[model samples]
Target: MQPATTAVIALHYQNEVLHPDGKIRVGLDSDSPVRQNVLDAASAMFQRARACGLPIVHVRIAFRPDYADLLTNMPIMRGVAASNAMTEGSWGAQFHEQLAPDTGSPREFIVKHTRINAFFGSPLEEVLRIVDAKRLLIAGVATHSVVEGTVRHAADAGYEVLVAAPACASASPVTHQAALDSMSLMAQILDANALAQFFDELPS
Candidate 1:
């Protein structure tokens, strides 16, 4: 995709989800290497995307300290509230160190969201519009949840979408693979090498 019309969005790469010490570690650390691997893999692509002048938007999920902003409508949502996870101003709600949002970069933006779909309750869609993005590169901590959710929304919204598969992880291999397979029908799924190479080859 052309750099001028493309953007990269890294979602939920937060301490609450991706860090080994995260409150809601999706899976046993040993059984899910993708959790950590995805950070390095996605970071590489983000660096290239930055160097190529493509806008980078970091999306995070957080709620009020009293959990006032969260709607515990489902079991998972209730779990988040019960665990007091991703509370605002807490380290657990912060982005992962490797893919931290750059506040000083003009083309970089941070969109705080509270729903499974990043675009549902956030300015992510408007950020893409502001950046004049026609194509999007997406990477999220959980492949089966946020990644898949956002991909479907982006597709339905008419933006060309690309998912960096290596940057996506889930509670298990089965879920991860299944999500990728399902997302492939709606968005282009790119392996780590291909994603890295795509960013590296982008025109500055």
Candidate 2:
């Protein structure tokens, strides 16, 4: 693998998803080992990709302030609506500081998405195409949701997908593990350290 052959897609690292004080943190244990692992792993993964000169694309879930684009009838969207999380201009919608794009890197891209799959209505595919990326290294919150959704979609779109398991979290550890197991059929699953090693070995 080379830097040009791979791009890292980080999904939904917004304050509403990763921060302890986030609006959607109700009933979630902020101090859990799983949660901490995700934060640390994802932060380190981002740093490694940046250092290796790989394109890093950050995907965020956000809706208009009026939430006109939000699907309020959906159970998850209802919860999101009630919590008022990830509104376009809200603080909860901003990317986590640790995983934010480096201002100095022209290879960094930030894309806003309204759907679970990052590519549904975003420029993700176009960006990846522009970078000539044949593979994607994925990391993010909610292993059962964004991580799985994006991986499946990417695989279907003809991109080889590698998931950083330790860099993903969900409200339930069981659900997270189950999602990872299922996704293994379509994507290669690696831990944060392994993902770092993979990128480090990529030819310059």
Candidate 3:
């Protein structure tokens, strides 16, 4: 089979200081812990994507707290009343060390911020369009939010979307699974190893 030119997308909850603590106070089902596992899986997936010369994109959540001067009001940003942790320039805003890629130069980072979906308010769609990417491999934190948001928009935009089952985590297991179940009907869902195998079988 021909190698599918793909883009691997990962969402990061670790923003600067103005964003909410995505899962610290949440329950066991919360995404914090699960997000880590998802990230680990994504890292492994990236190895295959890299070998296939596919593009990798990381979505970040960062907000300018000035509600008076907001860009577009998205569902996730409805409560702009106060910022929790993710800001523009804080350690918490940074991507978890494990999920962050080493590009050897700060100038080139996969990180991109958006108000809602990875494609919304961000240059993601444009980038993919430039690369002529037809398939998107997605995994991220807050399956209910970023992951869902991205998938819906991606589908509407007419791109083939795939969700990395083990590469996603949400605030609750129910929410996570629900999102997966729903997306599965519209997109292909695969784990890291399965994804790797797909890429491996692809002809160069």
Instruction: List the RMSD of every prediction in angstroms.
Output: 2.2, 2.2, 4.3
Query: Candidate 1: which stretches are off by over 4 Å?
Result: 1-3, 30-32
Q: Candidate 1's residue-wise lDDT over 24-127, tens digit each?
A: 87664834666668777878877788788889999999999999888888788899998989999999999888888779888899999998999998999888
Best by the TM-score measure: 1
The Cα error of candidate 2 at residue 70, in Å, is 0.8
- For model 2, how does the per-residue alpha-carbon lDDT over 123-166 read when each residue is reduced to its tens digit? 99988988889999998888888889999999998999999898
| TM-score of predicted structure 1 | 0.94
Using lDDT as the measure, what is the rank order of every candidate, best first?
Answer: 1, 2, 3
Report the C-alpha displacement of residue 62, candidate 3, in angstroms: 1.0
Candidate 3: 10-residue stretch with minimal lDDT: 17-26
Give per-model TM-scores: 0.94, 0.93, 0.78
Runs in model 2 deviating more than 4 A are 1-3
Error of 1 at 166 (Å): 0.8
- Candidates 1 and 3: which is better by TM-score? 1
